[model samples]
Target chain A: MKRKVFVASSIAAALAGCAKITNGLNEWQPAQPILNSAETLNQAIIGTRGTARLYRPGDVTLDYPVNSLDTPHQPEYLSLIESDFTTYRLPVGGLVDHPQTFTLRQLRALATLDQITRHDCVEGWSVVGAWRGLSLGSFLKLVRPKPEARYVVFYSYDHDQSGQQFYGSLNMAQAVHPQTMLALDLNGKPIDAAHGAPVRLRVPTQLGYKSTKWIRNIALVSNFKDIFGGQGGYWEDAGYAWYAGI
Target chain B: MDATAGSSAPLPRARSSEAGVVVRRHSLVTRTTHWVVFIAMIVLTMSGLQIFNAAPYLDASDKSDPARRVLSLDGRTTPAGSVGVTTILGHELTTTHLLGYTDDGQGGETARGFPGWITFPGYQDLAGGRRWHFFFGWVLVLAGAVYLIWGIGRGELSLLILRPSDLPKLWPMQAYYLRLRKEPPDHGKYNPLQKAGYTLVLFVLTPFVIVTGLVLAPGFDAVAQPIVWLLGGRQFARTWHFVAMLAFIGFFFGHVFLVVATGFVNNMRSMILGTYRLGKHEGTGP
Candidate 1:
């Protein structure tokens, strides 16, 4: 009888003790602050300061159009031949046999290729699009790297005024992959400025950011440690996983 | 001897007080179902942890080396065929690729299936998780159903579910509780707070967990498309599933505390044996 009483009282007391949050109405709150001020300021500058360029499929025409800004996805690929943006320059420097800058017409002069692939994002989203551009391998062949060159880094005109280059890197193995193309067209039409126009890197097997839209400069490096944030890409340096593969 | 008989009559009355009062509380079925839930909660929480450890969120230093390999996160090949993989600090590949498979004659190549045996340093593949999770899930659901049925039959459901009176009493009871000035509210089989929690777990959280889990079924996606859409998306469903796990963890600890607080031995015995010690009765006759 005593044991039974002890057990009943003890268990009841235990159940009662489980009620910890006496007030349940006010506990729910946001997990973290919505935005940081510094990040918002940086984003505002990057958003407004770029000239949009349009790129079309199978069109290898590159022009050096002097534009005030070169932001991503500017929907300017269609009116390229008529737009005030007339000149396009491909800057090739850093660890190369020939540090030569090429006109848009010069880039278009190379063998062009097109591929349809999916662009996956780390935030659990994807889109299928067609891309047209010169083979990065062919371009690398033009400006041969010295034996020490191990990685190719692409810099974009999309940058903060602070000279922090928005960049991405690829090992030589992937740079030479047959399908790797520097696309100037998207979705069977001229690449929209809202998308990377002029030219962008399309790496089918990786996430969207790896594609590095609105590319402006190419640098050959022996190692990746010297780059900003040293993680390989712009978004990567800003807390995104560098290899955001599906 | 006639005088001795009179003395014996008084002894019966004193004996009644010593024996204490008996309260018929939890039914046998209720007791059984409660234990089943207790066991299931323990197993589920432990297994869930093992699964979470398989894929953790990335940190800054995690972008360098060692950590990335351990986390099994690598870069996807771009359409350009460029493979830009990240090397995080502390992410070194010690184990061979365990989750990879090569497709067999379908559209693409298949890889080896996950090893069936339980071993450390091996990936906890979806197969193993599904096996244990599904098996225990059935047990949990069945036990819950039985509990509900038994509760209704015994009219214990009314006692366990909150009534209109419980709302007004909830605040005062809570204040008394926070101050530790009053013992637990004494009414029927369960207090208002206990009823509310159990009801929420049964009606809201558990059902959502079970339904979302079903949506993850491979071929069942087509059939469960409506549910998936209603929940926003598959990823959203997964997020809710994780959130539900947190709720269950809270419920589990709370349940244990209540068990220990309310006459541990007596409650445990009643749950296991379906009997409570008899106490003195002031007015009622047995």
Candidate 2:
């Protein structure tokens, strides 16, 4: 695991030189290991570089809300969030050495960070909200993920446009990034239902979609080959790009 | 240099070359930027359309009527029967069904424009499409910056600048384009209409799209927020970007048709090979 982390940081160190080769037009050709490295290196770079794996951020103040809710309210989610998320329990399990669970209060007790950042939607809009939450990296350290765990998959209670369960994933480096957080507050207040209340993954570097909202579980897995649509995330299954750091 | 393409001589040269009357039309910088920007335009447009396909709704921009939406071709549909088929706004000339609708192979119907064939990845992958869009969007911006800087430094930007004197020349060129006038104006490298078209696209619309695109980007917000807020909002910037894209498409078709009608070889050769043959005298046909 340490070696993987070291190789990732090393590759990301030179990612700017290989941006074209990794996510460039050639990514469509699945057989090219060079291209695969480009992607891995891209994630390493974006997620690990200054904000590697993470895309670029505004050098200035990050307080902006582009838009809200691409989908309408769901009754299931409505009922689930009705208790004000005070009863919310975030289950962290699957391929890990120490599986654990945390209630809302317990999560609040962990080390927290407040960041004002932008949320870029794939549909070409952006919003900035202040997020305060416990660091995902701190939680991962506690969970002690097994060496076999490569992908940290996030499952949400929210339903997608296709009526299927919404889920997103991060490669190990992304999941364990120090900045990644389980955001409980938005704009100085608890995140409301429409904004992925209870808890949402506030990934300052990734697109809004990859930051799974209404968090329920985090599953560590070796690969996503057989999961959902077998591409990675719910949107990934519906033909979206799995690695959408851009 | 503007001295080459934007020369204020207002007179066509009498000299000629064996290949053509090679009066340096476009500069090396011009040619390179043009070709690069054209490719970037294709990639940006295709990927943009793909991103649009994911959500495909346009809010009518009224607080009380937030739900009133004009569906994009991906969400829109044409009322059957030929006369009033609600075409994808500006794509009326293109009769392909792919431009406005899709049969999802199931009973449920969907609306889409430009078809998957012309889109990047040619499938429903907004994520991949976005990467391509952002990537090429940067290329387009860089090339545009190069063109602008080169044109400004060389005074070539004046080539596309319109003046009161250029207006009268338009009437004669329009007549010629309509075949009413037999003799073409001696407007040198570019005629009045060409100048106006190029001017509007290069100095006006392209910048509008670029600035608005920056407004839509989350990363550029600190610097772009003022402009974005002034332009109504992020959604409005996106709306204008879409409008600018349509304007480009319109410009492209008209530009291509004119190139084909006015000695395709001479026009293409001038752009690519930097040598345009003298009309009729050089054995070239329009």
Candidate 3:
């Protein structure tokens, strides 16, 4: 009881001086200043504590929409023209020794595998899809990233609700995980425009936001401080955790 | 098998009420856990509603769009009537100015489930709302663990569990609640309804929410995949989580109403001070 009272008093005292953790713009986040840092401390703890997670093999989705695709055009994406994307080149810049660009066909020609995994979203929904692509680890080896590169940022042609350019970032560790892929095919078929056509990043271990849907550039940087808005991803830029393992 | 099977003192249900005798009704541990769970429940509910507002509703599709939101709950937010529709019970809440779906104040429609008034942070940040929900999630989880461990250590948990004999008393308890009986059965501190409610909240609902919640977390996906498959799928699990929150809201309000209805001061005093007056109307003071 004494302990409880002490703890309660401490929390009450802390709350007495509450300030808005975030008052800027994020589409899906609450605008209430009272709720800004409410969960940030908690998320930080979870993010720091549970950095690694295991991926269990699961069956393919039994249905669609709820089971497969979550979005098509809600966040605006600029699809390169058929001819432009046919010869599309993904610029691999940032802290890399062998800065290179690979066309969609070249990326598809590399060693690849099909992975059927569940896509978990922070918005309280998930779906299973068979994603086929070249392993990010393999791609990283080809580019030969510099030792200083600690994070990977994927730029998207997609626009958020507020018309800002969409982007997502990941720790280099997650960026090169075996399950991480630059997906070109979904469910044994060439990826369509509705999805991130041509190619997209797929990191099964992270939330959907971390998996950037449009293929344009892969920048290996020491930190995301230099990226647009610098929150890591478009969602992260708003109010999401930079490392969304959960 | 029973940790404290022989150590617990039986509740004195038949103690005489002469001179308005008082009895030790609640233990310090139970009281603390109850209040902590109450606070956690409120935070979890509000944060949950905030998250739900982002999507506002659910739809199952194989070729689902890769957009932010294609469908939304329609209210006045949509044009005079733009075929915007959503449902809670069997009734479709498609009319303007309905609960959850409302005008975004910009001419354009937005399907935010609940207003800022009731949700945590009173804003649309799904990320922040999730953080708040998870913070209290651990509180609820830890408090529940302590309750199980301590309740079993003291053998008090058996008091809340439904027994075969409780079936026969169900009718009588309902009659008492309905005011059909003269007085409540000489229940030991907690009436039958209280026992049932407590048992459901502690044993059934709490575990259900925690397990379903675990399934929702991406980190637990591997370890809990089988459980997720068993429950159906990830979306099904989310739907269950939402349903459980509603059930919790119902339980919370019902619990409060009962406490207030059955002599609020006495009930509060028992949970707070440990000593409770002998009868429903034994003492004016708690």
> Taking the true A–B contacts (Cα pairs closer than 8 Å), what share appears in each candidate?
0.00, 0.10, 0.27
Q: B94-141 in candidate 1: lDDT tens per residue?
A: 222222232111222223222111111123332233233444566687
Q: Candidate 2, residues B83-133: lDDT per residue as tens digits?
A: 212333333333334445642212222455444545664555666666677
Off by over 4 Å in 1: A1-246, B1-20, B52-123, B180-186, B277-286
The candidate that wins on DockQ is 3
Lowest summed lDDT window (length 10), candidate 2 chain B: B59-68
Residue B194 of model 3 has an lDDT of 67
Candidates' C-alpha lDDT: 0.53, 0.65, 0.65
Provide all candidates' interface root-mean-square deviations.
19.8, 11.0, 7.5
Ranking by DockQ: 3, 2, 1
Q: Chain A: TM-score in each candidate? A: 0.64, 0.73, 0.72
Better of 2 and 3 by TM-score: 3
lDDT top scorer: 3
lDDT value, candidate 3, whole model: 0.65
TM-score per candidate: 0.40, 0.60, 0.73
Model 2 bad stretches (over 4 Å) = A1-27, A30-102, A106-120, A124-197, A202-206, A216-246, B1-20, B27-29, B60-71, B74-100, B103-114, B149-160, B163-168, B175-185, B279-286
Listed in order, the DockQ scores are 0.01, 0.09, 0.20
lDDT of 2 at A172: 77
Q: What is the lDDT of residue A126 in candidate 1?
A: 30
Candidates in descending lDDT order: 3, 2, 1
Compared with the true structure, what per-residue lDDT tens digits does model 1 show for residues A146-203?
A: 8899888998756655657668887776677666788876665656565666777877
- What is model 1's C-alpha RMSD? 22.6
